[model samples]
Target: MAKPKAKLETLQDKEILTSELAAIVGKTPQWIRQLTRDKVLNQVSRGKYNLGEAVQAYCEHVSGGKEEEQKPRLIDFKTRYEKTKAEKAELELERIKGNLHAAADVEWLLSDMILTIKTRLLGVPSRVSTECENESADVVESVVRREIETALSAMAKYTPDQIGGDVSHGGPEDS
Candidate 1:
């Protein structure tokens, strides 16, 4: 006995049910219905579908195939400019603070030297006595002068410009 040949029918513009689509896709009928309900697959007609459109929609959903939306980045030109400006201001403030500390140290050293010389001169009893003794006065004056000269020379070697300002302040007019 011989078997009969299968007939080939031309497809028409029509709709199919979930069971028929599941047969074409080789999935369970219930899974096809779920996909339709989730809108991953859309119905072209009631209880029917287009095979090509269904496959396209399923591929798009599974392949991370959404159109990319452009978003603005958080870091822009204005933000960078403001950050750089802040860093520069902080550096400048540090420099000014350093200069102020240096000036204070210079003033402190000058004051300490002046006080030491004054104390030494007062220790000479004859110089502080009621009688104006010429010899004791000369000795005190000579010692004070030598000490002031040494202090000024040391200052000039370390900070010439500052010492020059002090020297220019108390002097006769230069010819």
Candidate 2:
């Protein structure tokens, strides 16, 4: 398939195709289209442009005469960069101050506590089965509850000391 070319309205007209303009301007056709979109270049038709006017516009665009419009964009970029840098620094300081713990450390702490409680609960039946067999129902129940309470009490005495430098990624240290 072939596309129809735009007809020149008059022999005196000075229009050029996108590719011709790009070649003369030392840029890609896409670059020409972008400049046109940015209002730095003008098109005489959908894919044709006035060669002299397009070149003049491109020269003006590259001459820094458009600095006023670009300064806000530059300032905005620098502002965002500084803000992000400050945020990262603040987070780092907070982490070093022991105000935050790594996810891995928290995960380890919970897993350790759960395993301890599970072990304690699993041992209860074996340790109290014979004693419970001879005791009253109330006594048996009290024994089981006491064992569970002891296991739970271990969690109440929570301490981060155990999450020491032993972790693969060094734990937060106290100064």
> Which candidate leads the pack in lDDT?
2
Q: Give candidate 2's error at residue 89 in angstroms.
A: 1.6
**What are the Cα lDDT values of the candidates?**
0.61, 0.77
Over the stretch 1-175, how does candidate 2's per-residue lDDT look in tens digits? Answer: 8989998676325899999989998999999999889887878889999877777777767664345753644446677899999999998897788777677677776777787788988888987797688799899999889888888897777676555435543433321
RMSD of 1: 18.8
For every candidate, C-alpha RMSD to the true structure in Å: 18.8, 13.8
Candidate 1 lDDT over 72-158, as tens digits, reads 323444577899999988877865665323444455556645665566555544333433445476866675566556555644554
Error of 1 at 12 (Å): 9.6
TM-score versus the correct structure, for each prediction: 0.30, 0.51
lDDT of 2 at 63: 61
TM-score of 1: 0.30
